[model samples]
Target: MKTFFQELKNRRVYRVAITYVIAGSATVQVVGTVLPIFHAPDWVQQVFVALVAFGFPVALVLAWCFDLEDGAIKMTCGDGRAVVTSRRVWILAGVGLLVAGSALTGYWLWHPWKRLSDAASMSSDTLSAPPVIEKSIAVLPFENLSDDKQNAYFADGVQDEILTDLAKVADLKVISRTSVMQYKTSAQRNLREIAKALGVAHILEGTVQRAGGRIRVSAQLIDARTDMHLWAERYDRDLADVFGIESELAQQIVSQLKSKLSAREKAAIEQKPTADLAAHDLYIRAKTLIASSALSTPQAESLLEAVHLLNQAVERDPAFARAYYQLAEAHDLLYLQGIDHTPARLAMADGAIQSLARLRPNSGEAHLAFAKHFYWCYHDYDRAREELTLAQKSLPNDPLPFQLAGYIDRRQGRWPESIKNLERAIELDPQNSAFLEQIARSYECLRRYVDAERALDRAIALVPKDAAMRARRAEIELHWHADARPLMSTIQAIIAKDSREGKNIAELWLYGLLCERDFDGALRALAALPIDGCHQETILFPRVWCGGIVARMRGDTASARAAFTSARNELAKLVREQPAYAEALCALGMADAALGHKEDAIREGRRAAELLPVAKDAIVGPLLVQNLALIYAWTGEKDLALEQLSIAAKLPGYLSYGQLRLHPYWDPLRGDPRFEKVVASLAPK
Candidate 1:
């Protein structure tokens, strides 16, 4: 105002105020946008700039419109009356702008919000070691070196004991049997990739050749990163000294790792198993079949055989607690898979625990198995953790407990922690496809497709015969890129496999349609599903997020919004019922972002993050994390979005890496510095 400016000129504060506002706005916009790059999600940085771009002019326009210049000293209208002049108006405007900026700033910092925008680029890194120590070790899976294949159990028993003994040492980071067994036959991938994939420095490989009373065992340790031989040893001994040989080998390996060891660890290595060699061998065979079965049917056959063998072993050596322990694990595995062998499972678990208690006062495997029995079969979390804790004490080197712990942590919604344990499990068993799948799933929850794909790739290679693995790979490729014809063809091949079995295989068609952006084709595929399961393939909470996916491919946000609304409702139902469906929550968050429901998107994405740790290992995790991260960036939660993307980038493997990177949801984050990092992190190893 001329009057206020005239009066304010005398005070000297008016000029300072305008200059300050201009400078401060510029400073906030410039510094705020870039600063978030270090801490905020990639998308959030873009949002920070956008908010400033939007807010400043509006603020300036208001200042001009209200004519509340000169700190509101006076505002005289043309009528020559002060238009309700109040100095508070100046303060109010400043306060309102600050409040708006602060609110947006908070959004820029939301962790879960950022996860939405970066979900697509999520991935699986580098390593360092303690300088004072040179690590060396070897791991050997129990080889089936029996003529009747009946003695296969004995070989497994030998390996298990050796692994257990090596695990007890504090100085060693022993690669668990699971990781080493990944190299059971052929390893096409380079050692570095294998080592990096396994999270282990050295790999131990061995073979067992046994004939009647005689045994020949040979082992060699190679550094995965350098392809250097750390150690090699062979033991030719009577079957009677089998236990002694394993114990001695473990001790020798521990010494070779070049780490410090405690007296307790040394004692643990020497502790004898309560199993007679013959009985233990039989028990090992049972364990082998029990571990191999995936579904309930095969699992049943294996466990039943285990029970029979264990009974014989028990009869042969009445004091064989190891036999009892395996018997317990078999029943527990079956029950957890919802197999109908509950009664047998329970009886066997109880008997094993009881026998183990008498044989050794503290045994982790028994307790861990007991925990699984209670947790999965009886629906008890506390008891499961408790048992796992005891198992941790007894068999610290065993990855099964940690694997189960990861599962438990997930069920509890501890995403970061669950993922950490799952990662540890992978380190223990690098080639275990199931564990790799789990790691992939964790990244997927954060929406890290890049990382997820690496894990998935490893899994696919491990068991090429696994139709499901191929199908999963197809799904990831479908979502990763809209224009990926090759990926679609891969998915189609996966579906064609099921055609022979008379299964619907509709998800393949639907996903293929979505990738092609042919809504009609998708609808046709959806219609072919068994009524209730149709939505299981598409138009469901997460599957429906592909609607937004489809719309984005078509460059039609309106269609995306409509699909998003439907997805939101579906997500709402999931949140209402279980409230722990992180993938569903994540999908909702992404849909919300596409539709411009920024506030709602952030809120929903946060819930998804909360639920991700506890989410089940499913096909949707990568999409969930990637989409949610994209949302956060769009809404201006830069730091959070970046953090989310970082996590997503490490997902074991993503079904759709390329597509998510190119999606419209991440458009807001494009060209951001942190986004570059996300891209780098997501690039293949």
Candidate 2:
């Protein structure tokens, strides 16, 4: 035993053992700390630690057999007689231990059965069970296998038709097209991950190939949880029979899922949208464009192209109810967004709705169209509500009815109901930033700044380049704590990225600058604004009006008068062209007030308020009244201004703490106790 101990010391085995343990410990610590930076799985760190531990016995064996002498590694010297049995025994034991540890560690880390058991255990736990709805499914974008890639729209149309048919079945929870479209061109589709994200147990994937008036569609339904194919089929048919193929596929999926389908749902699914294939193709393209555009800030050129396509579609098939509905919606958005706020635009929307009503008087599409018409064109919340109720009953899975209901509820000051309806919309269309923005708007109106910011944060995450949403997110800080730094920083960042894109949010940038009393920055922003002006909801401010405000802020009376006069003339012409445009009248009233036309300003402001009263439109109505307050302030009507300001402050509107505290428009009544009290009421707790 003494000789064995001396041999171990002479070989420097103690040093090797201590060094190995220290190195192993350090390696484990380094791996544990570094792996998480890359978001490595928890099991990765555990496996790494096990690997380091498994090396312990191997290090001991090597240390026992070898010696580090001077600068060279050499085998330990032994007497010429025979190798010691005890040393041999100890080395063998170390080698055996190393092999055993390695084998066990590898098995523990990589065993398939163990992984399966763990997964099963997790699935069985009710507290941590995956949210997988048995009857829920997401239809991924069908691959376009046509030679002409431009026919991608045709493939999309096929997929959309199938999805629409499936959505009609009330028993199945079909993920909306907007949400599933993200996975359309994904190079790697993780079935389980996608299913979890979409909260569905089933996933449907397909391919569409079209050539020379013939089409082939292959669809497969998979149990995403188990990666098992439930059903699959391939259809080869003429282009004219595509609708039948979609209907048959929908029926098969419904049967496979064991979903109950009502008679009406079956009929609706089987009903062809258009008899003409060309018309169907056009309708599909138009609908695709509409889906890509945002509801709050729609692309005007895309909408115009969609209108042209839908018109051609309707002309090809006079009784295409869906095409007419799309047409009405396109025109309604055009009018609502002020892209083409003309009577002629409303007339076109009305014509489309009339045609739709004639074709499908009691259809969900008809009710939705009428609801949008009432809400967007007439601001008739009551009529829109009635239509929305009918639409909801017929379109159980549709998100539009709920989204519109939320909008109406917001306008009617039903904040909680609006939030509930918007949340419902989000559940059906999870990827829709527009719904998120609408919910954020309700939170903002209610002065729930944190909730509003959270909603906008989610919206911004969905669309990182959405300048309007980012601007709104920054504006929340201003509204909450009278802070303009965040708004200015966000705007500057956006502008620095692309100055041309700044025009999209020029109004917000100007607002931030004005809030900080940065007159020069406000002037620059106004100069960059579009000549036709910018819009905030229903109100349209001519660029000249913004210029006038900037000049007034700088105390340049001459420039202010000239800019206001120009704005007044332009707005007066617009009012003449659009006599009932309350937004235009409001701008004109402000311009008159700036030019010192006191009576004329007051009369125009009153008329504009009367045209769109709060009773009629709780959303835009308060904006007009707020503008009236500004008009009174400019005209030296202090008491009247304070009274109107008080009323506007109490209502749900764009009124913010930053605006009330910082904007110069209310300078006339700034020192008054009533005006100060109104501003105080808006301060964040």
Best by lDDT: 2
The digit string of per-residue lDDT tens for model 2 on 180-238 reads 88788799899998888777899999999999989999999999999999999999999
User: Candidate 2, TM-score vs. the true structure?
Assistant: 0.78
Clashing pairs in 2: none
Give a tens-digit lDDT track for model 1, residues 628-657: 677888788877777777776766434235
Best by TM-score: 2
Q: What is the TM-score of each candidate against the true structure?
A: 0.56, 0.78
Instruction: For model 1, state the Cα shift of residue 579 in Å.
Output: 26
Q: What global local distance difference test value does model 2 have? A: 0.83
